[model samples]
Target: MRAITFVPGKQGTLGITDVPEPEPGAGDLLVQGLALGICGTDRELISGEYGWPREDPMILGHESLGRVLQVPEGSAYSPGDLVVGVVRRPDPEPCGACARGEFDMCRNGEYTERGIKERDGYGSERWTVEAAYAVKLDPGLGTLGVLVEPASVVAKAWEHIERIGSRAWFEPRTVLVTGAGPIGLLAALLAHQRGLEVHVLDRAADGLKPALVADLGATYHAASDLKAVGFKPDIILECTGAGPLVFDAMLNTAAAGIVCLAGVSSGGRLLSADAGQINRDIVLENDVVFGTVNANLRHYRAAADALSQADAAWLERLITRRLPLDRAPEAFDRGQDVKVVIELGE
Candidate 1:
């Protein structure tokens, strides 16, 4: 099968090449790739920063939407079903935390997280995986629901925000989302659905225009001047992964407000979030700070539900560009791309 892969044996180089198709293991589902997304992590994996197997051929794509080509006869999902799966392929332990229905804490695990390890990924003509990892989308949901995985990531933050928040669903309050990256825009969209007065901040106004068109969130701003304007919010989610800005949001959140840190750094640089600063600025201020990672299965369901409820107009905004696998590199080049989908075998 043809794929764009990172072929570094150790501390090494990046390139695209052909590779063998995957063999779905026990409880596995074989899926044909329909569309895949290029994520920042993929870029880092290319540079060998995200810890790709130092001595193996690494397949790097984790975001995708597709259809089941085959599965065991009684696999609980039908072949030809539309699906979207997560980035993580966790280890299995039936008697452990996940089997007790606690998937997030599952221990004895193997991450067949393709494009990052020995496992082949979805950025190819075909992919095979554990049927348990597959998530079937309702036929009623369509293409946008096909995007449920990433969107659910945003929804998870909202679920957490709503949980920690004192504001009732009936009461309207503002939320300030910093950064207009895909994650940030998605956060804004979720906040909009919750009926919060939403403010989106982004330096590239054009970059945020699509989000504006969806009316996913109202008001865009230069990334600069966020602090000077006093756009205090009951909740703020820092999706840019800029630690300094995270601290800014922490300081600015209204009393009893919540903040979610949703981004991952690429350059491998560290920032200081002083303990005294946390005690004096956030804790003393009675703010909630949550460092959230990937969502569990429930967030996936909620994200699907939200996608199902959303209008067609919104999905169109999210799918900014659809490129063939060969053109995938351009998707990562900086400037003028919100979310780029690689249409596999198109």
Candidate 2:
């Protein structure tokens, strides 16, 4: 079997390597890898900017889609079932959150993620996952199921946003999503589903991004500044981790607003800001600014449902490139496309 392998913290080590076939354990499902999604995280890992160090090469994909080749009898899954493997697993000493199947909120910071942390991932011709950590998807999704992992992230964000909004008679009318990337676009999709007026801001002046936003019945802004958005949004889903944009989102929301920071910003870039003014804005307006990452099984299920209900053609357009497994490395190159997928098998 062949798998994408790389050493953590070592640049230029990503490559395709032959590895032994995976064997299923009790209650484990043996799945044939179908596809893998490439994102900023994968790029960082390949560049040695992120990921935990390991002496041996580790499998390098987390956004995974596979079809069951074998499964334990009496299990909820069966052969030919389409599935996605959940990324984060509970810490050895289960925390309060992890004990409740909410490892996404693991308080100890000791949780292990499939590709980014201490565990091997699903970027192989064959992979084995404990049935408990596998999420079944609609067979109709096909290779599009590769998106479930990233979508799970935004699903968690939306879940948290609505929870915070419920503190009062919250009927949010408008939402501003910064960055028109997959996360931002999906955030806009969920917002539009809720009947909110959605506005997406991206630096792309004219491209598929703006068109995609328009197709969703949302407004798109081709500017770098939040002030150009024209109206104060009731909710801000900040998908661009740019420091300036993060601060701008905090200051540019309506009273009793919620700002969800979903992007991971690289460090070392400093910015000047007025702490007093930013604090005053939040305090006076009863605003809530929170950051969210990762997702539990519940969010994955929610994401699958969201994708299943979405326009199939629109979802298909999100995936702009697909390369075969042998050419997996090319998928990591920075591109303007919304999603890049590595096809592992038919």
Candidate 3:
């Protein structure tokens, strides 16, 4: 089997290599990779800025959609079924959250994340996952199901937002999503599905992103334009990790607004901010800012359901480029790509 392998903490070590096939244990399902979505985290790993992988030479993909090649007897999935393997797994010494099936909220810092942390990911020709962690997708979803993993991240964020918003008379009508990447765009999709007025702010106004935002029947604005005539959003999904934008989202939201920080920042860019005013705004407005990352089985199921209801054409447009396994390196190039997928052979 050919897989994309990298030595974590070693910059410029990513490449395509041949590896042995995955052997499934009892209650496991063997899946052949169909498509793997590349994101910022993969770029970070390639640049040696992210956390070290559990395995020295690690495969690098978390957003994966595949076809089951073999399944254990009595498993929910069957051979030839479309499925996605859940990424995060509980630690050996499980925390209270992990024991209760909330591994995404694991109290301990020892959880293993496939492709990101202590496990080999789904960036290979074939992989094995326990049946419990394999999520079956609607066949109609096809390759678009690769978006499910990132969608799951936003699903969990929305779940937490509603939980926090319920403290007051929460009838949110407007939403502002910062950044127009897959995560931000998907967040906007979920908000649109909920009948909220969606506004997306991105740097690019002429690329596939702005066009996609327009196709959603939502408003799109550049950051400069948004700053000039701002709308206080009821919910702010901060999908850009740029420090200034994160601060702006916290400072410029509606009263009783909920802001979810879904993007991870790279440090060292300093911006002067008025600490007192930021604190005052939060205290007086009863605002909430929370950060969410990774997803559990529940979110995966919710993401699958959301994809099932989404416009298939819109979902297809999110994938800006597709490359064969050999051209995987080109997929990491950050040149105007919305979502890049490496299509593996069956």
Per-model C-alpha lDDT, please? 0.70, 0.94, 0.91
Highest TM-score scorer = 2
Off by over 4 Å in 3: 53-55, 224-226
> Candidate 3 deviates by what RMSD?
1.3
1-346 in candidate 1: lDDT tens per residue? 7776665444345555778877777787888888788777776677655654655566657776778888887788788888776656455434366555545445665433556555656677687766666677877775565477678788878877777764443243888888776788778877888877888776664644544634764666665536744667877888887767766777777767788888764456687767686678776767778877666667877887777777767666777788887787776675576777778753
Candidates by TM-score, descending order: 2, 3, 1
Q: Model 3, 333: alpha-carbon shift in Å? A: 1.3
For residues 275-317, could you state the per-residue lDDT of candidate 2 as single tens digits?
9999999999999999999999999999999998888889889
Worst 10 residues of 2 by lDDT: 138-147
TM-scores across all candidates? 0.86, 0.99, 0.97
Better of 1 and 2 by TM-score: 2
The superposed Cα distance between candidate 1 and the true structure at residue 287, in angstroms, equals 1.1
Lowest lDDT sum, 10 consecutive residues, model 3, at 222-231
Cα shift from native, residue 230, model 2 (Å): 0.5
Two-way TM-score contest, 2 vs 3, winner? 2
Per-model tally of clashing residue pairs:
8, 0, 0
Q: Each candidate: RMSD to true structure?
A: 3.3, 0.7, 1.3
